[model samples]
Target: MPESATAAPPLQVSSETAPLRQVVVHTPGEEMALVAPGNKDELLFDDLLFVEEAREEHATLVRLFEAAIGDAGAEGGAVLQLSDLLREAFDGADARESFVEALVELLPERNFEAYEAELKALGPDALHRFALTGQAPFAVSATPLPNLLFTRDLSAVVGDHPILSLAATAARRPESAIIRTIYHHHPRFAAARERLIELPEDVTFEGGDLLVVNERVVMIGQSERTSLGGVLAVARALLDRTSVEHVLMVNLPKERYCMHLDTVFTFADDDTCVVFPPIIEEPRDHVLHIEAGAERGGDGPREFRMRPLPSVREALEEVTGRSYTFIPCGGADPIRQRREQWTDGANLFAVRPGLVVGYARNRATYEALARAGFHVVSADDFLGFYGDAAAASQDRIAVRLSGNELSRGRGGPRCMTMPLVRMRNSES
Candidate 1:
């Protein structure tokens, strides 16, 4: 078949395959070494270890995903590598210059000339090391990208547009740069350049904080990483470009565990989601809905406004046009909710409508999923099913991972895997 004949797929909203059409992932790199004992907190991680072993564990994840979703170069799906995407983005003179300029703007304290020269000379592997280590060759100082392993936190897709995230913390800025470069330059996504949205100024957003429940509705978390301004930027972009009717901005505590929306909530199916009860149920907590302007040329785009919504429960029901069952993470116990939420219990990745993946360490959360009628299975089990032709037809299964060490870095399975394509519901 001709390349042009291969039409781009339609966007889906489920974690099963929305926002994330093509994801750029970095297998754990030398950057993890920067998370020293005393600097763990500063790095936004709880502990540090060898990069080689981490890479090995991460490789298992990549293999499982490839087996399940298929590789980009192969038949079923696509997986865009960060290194390849970065190289493509830096291909042209204009793009390269623009990127270097952006990098300089981000790191004004450093000597631009030396930094540029050193980065230009490095190959992909060396560049990966440089980006992770934040090491400069000459007089310039480098800033380490410690959290790149949590790829889901860097950037996200809202509808068909890719929004470049501005992390709320300084520790994650390098990740933003890498993602920006990738989206700006990758050939696989060249068609999306005109649709790219960025908040290079005061706004801050993270993929972990934004959830595209559908083309018409998005769920945003007002947490440490995503700001009010960022939400507005995303809202404006969606309103201007798509038929998004509502942006549900959920206010989360700007604390350690509740750093992003995904830490406390994720979609399980079109009409169901997992949530932390305290925020979703508390009447005092602020949750608002910003309606998108009517279709372009209709009503001249309402002045990008926001209004307080009922409750998260009600808001989701209203937007989805159906009442959803809220499966509380950490079972029904408030104590378990607090404890497991801290370890990313609510952070689950949906591979298909009813199939999700998360950290197995959250035992209470797993039980809750089971209680909710989900067939909970370990990562190994899920991988086994995928590898077996006989079990491939099964639809409802949760892929659980041994995320004790990984989750200490403030993320879970959802934070790790980025889905590219999803099987759409024929009835929808």
Candidate 2:
């Protein structure tokens, strides 16, 4: 497909646990392989990952995602690939100039003339590959976007709105640039331009830090990947444009393993959440409750009511009406908790109310989930069993994908998924 020329349907994502209908993901390619062991730290990777193996793991996610949704072409939904969107944006109608201009704006002024000259000569197909691999058949120095495969960081789709995130590091800038361009020019999403909330400069909020609880509430984390300003900005925007009434700000420990909220927390059902106990149970952490001013105002001087929360657990319930059963990331053993948290054992992407996708390597976390009444199954089993329809064990299953090699890239299922649409409960 050249592009989603059919005017893809508008996206709607309100609850984290609603059935995941459509999502965006990127397969690891040359850019991912460019991260050498010596410079891995600079690229935010703990170790070098086997790109081929990681690509295979990502394929499983796409298959599982598509199977859960039933059909790719049905209801204007599909597992939209990031590279494919980039290709369409560069190759499709009147998209070249727009995409190039957006990309150049992110680069330094001195290099703009050179990049523009080189980018124009490459044609649409080369330009698409350039966006991912940062390489070309021709000559040019480009920023290696090693972390693009972890597509969850670029932007977020919140209740009919897409918020493009600003980058925290120079290496990750291309991720945002491509995401912004695709949403603005791609025929699938350009129509939502009016509803899009563009993040301000240096706010540095990634999607992993932004978690939607329900239409009435959103929870953004103050973690390594997201700043205080980012949380506040998103919280305010959600209140202004969406049905979100309050934003719960959970402060995380400044640690690599706890880089994002999902590294330590994620919803599994309406009344359950998988979490790393230390962060959620720590007394020293902060949880701020941000609400809009007494009256409603969109373009006027907005007033924000801020207060410190006694606890994020209780405050979240107040907003979503669910006293969630907290399932520890690892089992009760502290040693296992620290071990599993390092591998993002807490980061499980909820497919629906009680079904989810997680890494199979997190044995301790798996044990915890099993105890919490989740039927753990392999991705192969889930896909084979369901074929092309919803699973019979839909509400109480966890589809575990093998991530032995992919885990080296330092993200789990939720980190790799950028959910664009999720079905709202019919009863709601």
Candidate 3:
């Protein structure tokens, strides 16, 4: 039997609003040191970050995920670190040897024997540290992966399949390989990673630009980080391999403020979405919809119907049979809207059907959410509520986390997280 017909992966993601089950995260490490006082933009970071402060901020985000446990206490959600995954992959001797060989081949020195000896002498944790943060002069100086913590840039999970992207920027290229390695070699994911969408090297895609709103629909953005070719490739893959029938292609401006789709647009709940007015409302975004077409004669290739779409909301309404509420990122002020959108005000990671996590600094954005019936609570308060049996509950809420250091890297909650599993709901 083909690999696609094999045992299903241990995870599934049908919608953006489902309860998150398992996720992969990478914290900022010494690789961040690659950016100095100058040319930070060359590496894709907006500002310098203190490693300790970023780590502390990440812990608070993790607390929100910890509290998102599903129906069973063990099923809600759990955090998995890339370092830990790499360490687990290294436990298998053959995989370890293969990784070392690949590393040596990629390096200019090609000191295979010396590299092998040093790697073998270190423990698993040291191996991750060595590979990621300590490979300064040789492996990652020029191509430092400071943005690896933005795990959402490399992959997007649709149902039981994970589509791995080829990053548009060279700075983020290595992250895809590292994640592919983990999925290929790690025991936990070995069987689960059966179906995948991997585009050609020339095509570029990123998770922040791809959103699986529901099982039958996916939205791929053409932005500074994701190309039109990338969207076509992923759209074809979804049509061929999964239950996805319609693919929405939204063209975003090639600018820094709207770098990714999630930067300017994200689903707030089942019936609402947070968006920058300039992109989703002003008609600046060029839209298209794609679906499978009739097959040709024998020995001929499959065809697709790609046509212009009036707006993404039209198809979404047809799919869900409901009208959506669009909340502006920075309220009604255009100046504040432009400024807040640059800070990732629209990027919110959903914890459940009506719950999400967002940056605390976007005051106007949170104010909009508040007016939309979203109870905005600090990360500490939410965590405290999780520990209390008598805590009052609301219909929906946004657990805000301190994002001073994190936002400096130019990504928000949804950009930092890569959800591997989201428990299925009745509607899902």
Candidate 4:
């Protein structure tokens, strides 16, 4: 029998701080090695990564996640590599064809139509390798997808509905296409395929710009990577299809440093989030509230009412009926805040409420988290005590993972992971 026959459970991510059940990540591979100084800018990398160290750092993260979620025996642990899922999706003939066509469409400049048949005939492993490195046995070479390391930008699963991204730049277009194919073909996500929310080709939206505040509210950032149109498109779709009642759109500075929402903001607990003080505390970044209007029948346009909010904190409070604490990325230091936020200080991934993981280099950020009541611990230390009674008794943990090599890719923990299935607060 094929591997897809007994695929993992379907996806269900309703809140950012829920206990993570399953997630998708891509380890740095030859595609990352392909990124050199000369072509680094073109590949959307500020600096070329040392592939081996990056992989080691990412493995530490994977192990941390595995330890937190606990192993699930033969079905694999909580961490799922995007490449492995792609290979499994390729088990189906239809999935292979879909992937080939999507790749061909994504790279029309490559003129892949001529070799379409030959590409589809390749085995799953060969196809996976070709997709990553963009090198085929038949002498065909396309731009490698180095940005695949940041799985969070490809797609986001929000409350059982998968919102597929449309890459804003050509360099990351293949990453979007490949992930869309996985969501559509992977058996674990088969149920989501029916309710998948795909953005229009004319608009650009990366998953990193989105955050699920709760089952009824989602936050999207209109930044360098996600357009205003993309924000509205995703909002309208969520309002129409899912249980989401409010979509808070945050207009971010159109700069590389604030390219995605996760870069400046991420949830650390049910009522807390770490944020760049300049952006969230100051009134520079505008927050707009998009609420679902009266429901309409088939062929009728969905009604969505929009209004401006004082800030993200107010918006969440209004929607969730609860107060929230915004922990500064750097501990009360403006200079340190800028320096740490540049290295993705706010981009922490939550395993469960009060339990998060992020870059160890962000000392100021970790210090801020500690000041905010979180117990900061190194990845190694956390691993040492993990699964023990003492570890289980501790609360508000902030696990620091080494990210010196991985930070070159300009994405931290949240940006490197795409949570698929998560146990909701109520469920937990």
lDDT of each: 0.69, 0.81, 0.76, 0.86
lDDT of 3 by residue, 326-353 (tens): 9999898998898888888899888777
Ranking by lDDT: 4, 2, 3, 1
Residue pairs in candidate 4 whose N, alpha carbon or C atoms collide under 3 angstroms:
none
Instruction: Indicate the TM-score of model 2.
Output: 0.93
Best by TM-score: 4
**Residue range with the least summed lDDT across 10 consecutive positions in model 4:** 385-394
- Candidate 1 vs 2: which has more TM-score: 2
Clashing pairs in 3: 69-76, 70-76
Tens digits of per-residue lDDT for model 4, 1-428:
25544575767887998778888899989999988888888888999788899999999998888777764311445788888878888878888889889978877877888899999999888888888988778878577888998999999888888888899888888887788888888777766678889888789999999999889989999999999899999999998889898899998889999899999999999899999989887974399999987768888977888889898888889989999999999778899999999999999999888999999999999998888888999999988876543224438899999999999889999999998888753653
Tens digit per residue, CA lDDT, model 1, 1-428:
22521334433333333322334466766567677877777777766756766676666666556555543222224455565556545545555555566667665555565568666665554554566677645455665676877888877765557778887776777677777776665455566677777874888888888887776788888888888888888788777776677888998888877888888888887666888888777655377988853355666655766678768888778777887888888888999998988888888876556767777888998888888788887777767766744124446666677765676677877787544344343423
TM-score of each prediction? 0.87, 0.93, 0.88, 0.94
Clash count for candidate 2 is 0
lDDT of 2 at 25: 86
Clashing pairs in 1: 72-78, 89-185
True lDDT of residue 22, candidate 1: 39
The runs of at least 3 residues in candidate 1 whose Cα sits more than 4 Å from the true structure, single-residue gaps closed, are 1-22, 50-53, 70-77, 87-96, 110-128, 283-285, 293-301, 388-394, 423-428
